[model samples]
Target: MATELNKGPMLGQRHVQSFLLFSAITVNFMTKFNAGVAVVAMTDAESTNPDFPEYDWDEMQRSYILSSFFWGYILTQFLGGWLCRRYGARITMFASTLGSAVLVALVPWCVSWGGWQAYCALRMAMGLFQGFVFPCIHAHLANWCPVNERNRLGALANMGIDCGTLVSMFASGLIAASSIGWPGIFYVSSGVGIFWCIMWWFFGADTPGESKLISEAERSYIENSISSSHKAKEGHAGTSIPVPWKAIWTSVPFWAYMITKCCQSWGFSTLQTEMPAYMNGVLLMDMKKNALYSALPYFASWVMAVVYLIIADILLTRNIMSITGIRKTINSIAFFVPAAALIGVGFLDSEQKTLAVVLMCTNVGINAGSTIGSTINTIDLSPNHAGILMGIANTASNVIPIVTPLLVGIMVKDNHDRQQWQVVFIISAVIFVVGDLIYLAFGQMVTQPWDAPDFLDKERSPNLQEEGYSKALEAKESTNVDEAKRKEIEAGLESEEPKKKALNDEL
Candidate 1:
């Protein structure tokens, strides 16, 4: 591994793969949030550019349009996992982005022909394709990232979400106000998506072994590191292990993670989808100011995500915390601090616009800690099945996005009413607090028994099975030791061989 490292550049092919994944996520989310900004120009008479057409959508209608993406999104999460496991992340992500681009281009015509209902249908179609993205990304990272570097590389990839949201919110406003008008938002986003599809098709890969672009040295380093960590027999190329669905469903830690995921989704969707409207209605900000302020929070979020990554690496490399402790600690900060800031935001009056912006930024920025926390917990629990696990969790969590806007529509009858918006913020805060508390009580970062079910057969005695598992891990780790240590381990194994053979004969 040292020789391989010396032979390659300081940054390897894996870093290139990470960068592409980051760009893929950025493009995907740009399309995802484009509607949030464009909706202002589409509906509000005051905000609409004179050159563009405006629709008279009521609050309920607007809510439907914003929430519609999750309708089809929910249906495909599990399927995405199956597809990724069966095929590969490279093709799955490529297909998703290409389909989403085509659908985005059709948005203006759909809305023009049939109004909000047609627009909702188009968004739903886009959701079906885009739903595959996250599962594929998780699976890809599991294959490409080393155990030690997981948090840093994972953060780099996930930060694309914030980058995408920032660009969409900030740039969509300018595009909408240009000579091309509201339709320009869809056009520009679609064009970017298409361009990304071209790049991903040429460069994206599922694993280091499969990539022609990767050096042999880097590939050996990644595979050896991952194999040592996972301690499972690597299967043949183009095949997958059977999913332990029953085991996953029964796991306590998985359930805890899922519940927190749902809560985070509810709060995140509420803010991501409705914040522009909040700025327009409550703060009375115009289109340009609304876009700029809404985008600023995500910029803070992107920056804070990097900070969280750095802090997490310090705690890990310095041995300041156990892996479980690190996960719980980071997750607690991600949830509790944001919950407090959200509640604070609710109490501010319209005159406290600057304070409200600060609070909202705090809420969103600190929330980025989740990327290093529960977001990557699926990978920790079972790297081999991370994609499928993500699929299951995402399917349940994304339902909250569908529910949030409708709930907001029912609660906030008057968009300009500060009291109603206060109620919405408080509810989100309560949910966030409750979910993190559950995770604190029940969540774990250790790999579960079921992660390698084939190795630990049900017929084995529990104590014997656990002892054997430890021995196997020790054997794998022995390979990385110095020659002196390696010789000692070999001698020890040879000494036990006669007893092992005698025991086997008796059995």
Candidate 2:
């Protein structure tokens, strides 16, 4: 009753989905950090463009604005996971991108009307929607990518973070300096996000089976390769898998991974939110040069992520190292190297500008290894629960961004004081080192027992089983088939008819 489909093209529909996912992330981060770049222009003592109004917001107010996005961001992580499970990643991501884009476009008007308070509220609302991003991404990856290709595909999708940051940081200053001024930054990001939403609406699919464009062979390949276990099969439909709450909370490896994420967040937030200020105060760079230098590190990070992805694929495919070994090894390098680089960054003064830039680049660039490390390990642990795991971890981790800016505002009364920044950098470095050690001690790459509690159960819902069969049938129907192939499929369907009747009777 079953037939083997021929393999499809080397670059299949999955890659197209990956590219769209990548573009979505790129647009998301552009919206996320547009404020980080725009704020510098907003608060400058003298406006480069006389047509735009500059606010006289103090350091504390600026910090609040910068951190406001995370305030709402922390509230929606668990909600995002639930949404992704109930609906699908495609729809969840669409809502996030569209809502965030609309909010971003409203920012300038909000700031003009209610001042900093209104601006913060808008950013928080944007954060609430954008919070769905990573959970949806992980959930989508789990459903779409095969086990053998997870590393490269995951890296390709997540690389958008660096690419988005690089593009936004570099272009924001130039856009602000142009005739359109700082408002152009928001408008541009919003426009790109809306464009992506349009593309995704037409093309994005939750699973290969759901896609009209995916070939039968490609769909079969992805589904078969991913569905190695009962849990994997269940996860493919975006069904609501039962949450193992006690098991997840009590898991030591999960906690270790969460701690590592938190630590990385602290270090990452410190640099991402504060780098513009650092360049302005300490390096004495103008907005344009500051943007260029700030962007360079993320460019390096993007490059390094690709390199890490290739190396990781080689190690796995060649069996040079186990997945566990590769994860820990790359994670250690990501954490320790960045920690050392950050310390070096702290000690350098304005006089050592070139060296400071180099170290900053190293600190950010080498950190890309973490993307290959703990980021996608949620899927490795439990494909069925990857979205929920990502949600829990991200909820805890994003708190650091909210707190880091407020702490920096408190600790550094004068941004020009090198000693003050030195303290901040040292704290971040210490966190990075400590986090990696915990991960090295307790992290795992193998699937957990809790991934499928239904494994031992002999009976499953007949309705669910029928639903899966119908989806496979639909996928077969959507593919272009020759007369002979159609005959074969019709015969296969005829053979499956009795089994389908039995399933319906059982239901």
Candidate 3:
């Protein structure tokens, strides 16, 4: 047992290991979103098909079926965060996926004859599992990537989320049209989710430093990050950070993130829960076209988000702007792109389907700017509790899915009413604008008030240097000091009377 100190730095393997971790993370992510994607992609055809009985295709029923998952999703945020923390990311997350997969396999069977309540219940069950996805991500990402890379790494990890939704939309369209049809879609997604569990057990590490799949240098890089973070903390905090709920909950910055998350989800979940139905029913498109068009916005948005994050990272690494600048610019523009794109949608109709779909893509793409919502402030406000804070905010976002649909349901009574959707769009845009503004006004790049070394001016108890101090270097120096003192004493003895005693002993 050499201790965490002697782990020793190795150079040049971080990028490779990061990629492997990202890939492993992606498959897990794909499993997580499979249900949402499959349902969206399957919407048009299933609703119209007489071959399937549960495929009622009624707007209210479709809306109900789709909207029901959010009920379960929103409800689980509190428990999901705690479960992830207690069980470890791999265990809790895997259980969610595995359970969801089993449930998914049962969907076609239940939905066909079991009726709306049963189907809704299944969706709720799925939501319970899905709620853990982002929280698990927050926990794992915090553990796995370094601080400097947190933004880009956060964006990359999130790419799995966006990519899963898009790929699901794309692949489900392909599969839904196959001979197996709608049920086939759920069946395939269920299988993928189950298979992913076995893969996770084999490859996933609780922390990146411990993953066998991670390269030594990568491991060293992660280990060093943990070590360096506590350099200033001395030995007070120990290996795990203490949870400070009062500070986390009462803080304005944390609330700002919650508000921003709420605003963003107010708009984003609209896309997730209702867009397929909206595109098909409101825009007067058929099923396949609905699926294809549904995916375009996410596809475009996904690409823009990655590029946006990389550029932000470049500016940060280059010192082109303060981290605050990055957060402000990203959030403002994220709001900007979507707001403009959504407004454009209000003016279009089925005759302008091409332009309308492009606008949808731009609108959602801009939400990628919400990465600040996902990564920036959580670390800034509470690095010690970012994951938990994210869980809180993620829980807040879940509130949107629950409320938005009911609001939209009342507003749109008929799915085809562009006027109603336009109102919803306006409401969503305002939410984003105001939320983004609040963030720019109050949010920041540093953690809490206590994070500053001298801010509170508490007597310098030793914990201050934990993240910042090099215990390894100190240990090496202490060993050298002890060895040198031993040598000096031995030499002095030899010089004094040791040689005479040695000869006498021999005689």
| Global lDDT of model 2 | 0.88
Q: Specify the poorest-scoring 10-residue window by lDDT in model 3.
A: 230-239
Q: What's the best-to-worst order under TM-score?
A: 1, 2, 3
Q: What is the TM-score of each candidate against the true structure?
A: 0.88, 0.87, 0.80
The per-residue C-alpha lDDT of model 1 at residue 95 equals 95
Superposition TM-score, candidate 3 onto the true structure: 0.80
Clashing residue pairs in candidate 2 are none
Q: After superposition, how far is residue 349 of candidate 3 from its true place, in Å?
A: 1.0
Question: What is the C-alpha lDDT profile of model 1 across 6-94, one tens digit per residue?
Answer: 33666888888888889999999998988888888899745757776789999999999998999999899998988887778888999
Alpha carbon lDDT at 105, candidate 2: 93
lDDT of 3: 0.68
Task: Count backbone clashes in candidate 2.
Answer: 0
Q: How large is the C-alpha RMSD of every model relative to the true structure?
A: 13.9, 16.5, 15.3
Q: Per-residue lDDT of 423-488 in model 3, one digit per residue for the tens?
A: 988888788788888888877777676443343334244565663477877888999999999999
Model 2 residue 239 CA deviation in Å:
1.6
